[model samples]
Target: MLKIYKTKLDEEKKLLEDELGTLGQVDKKGDWEATPDDKMVTQEVQDEGDMADRSEDYEERSIKLNFLELRLADINRALEKMNGGNYGICEVCKKKIEMDRLEVNPAARTCKEHMDKVV
Candidate 1:
């Protein structure tokens, strides 16, 4: 069971990192930052419309990158827990998390009963 979850998490981590790579890059601080469009950056902004378009695109990518980063963080945390020999334990109750819930969300931090509190 643990192996299955770890494999799933490893696959998901790769996929998420690949998806994130398309929209942004890791900065010096090891955090993801949205990259501006190459064309927009190289060419001069001729009008307000062009500027707005670039801004909108950057904002959209930034928002998406932020969401992907959060998911990646959770996956990383879960993997760390797995390595620490406490992968399926609930953070809130200090009990073994339900297998069904772990199946649904391998990175779940709390049991079904205490899920809301963490959320």
Candidate 2:
């Protein structure tokens, strides 16, 4: 059972990393940051529409990158817990997390009772 969850987590981690790589790069602090489009240096006057489009695209990528970063953080935490022999335990209640919940979210940090309190 643990092996199954670990495999799922590994697959999810790889997928998230790949998707994140398409939109950004990891920084010196190991945090993902969205890369903006290269600024055009041509002498021709730039259109306002083009500038707005670039800005919108950059904002979208930033939002997506942030979401992926949060998920990656959770997955990493779960992996660390597995290594420490503390995986699948509710952080708030100190009990074994229900298998069903774990199946739904392998990185869950709390049980259903404390699900709302999860970080």
Q: Rate the local accuracy (lDDT) of all candidates.
A: 0.92, 0.91
Query: Model 1 segments beyond 4 Å from truth?
Result: none
Q: Evaluated with TM-score, which candidate comes out highest?
A: 1
For candidate 1, write residues 29-105 as lDDT tens digits: 99999998887766567677888989999999999999999999999999999999999888988999999999999
lDDT of 2 by residue, 67-91 (tens): 9999999999999999999999999
Tell me the lDDT of candidate 1.
0.92
Which runs of model 2 end up more than 4 angstroms from their true locations? Answer: 39-45
Error of 1 at 26 (Å): 0.4
Please give each candidate's TM-score. 0.94, 0.93
Pairs that clash in candidate 2? none
Error of 1 at 71 (Å): 0.4
Sum up the clashes in candidate 2: 0
**Model 1 residue 61 lDDT score:** 97
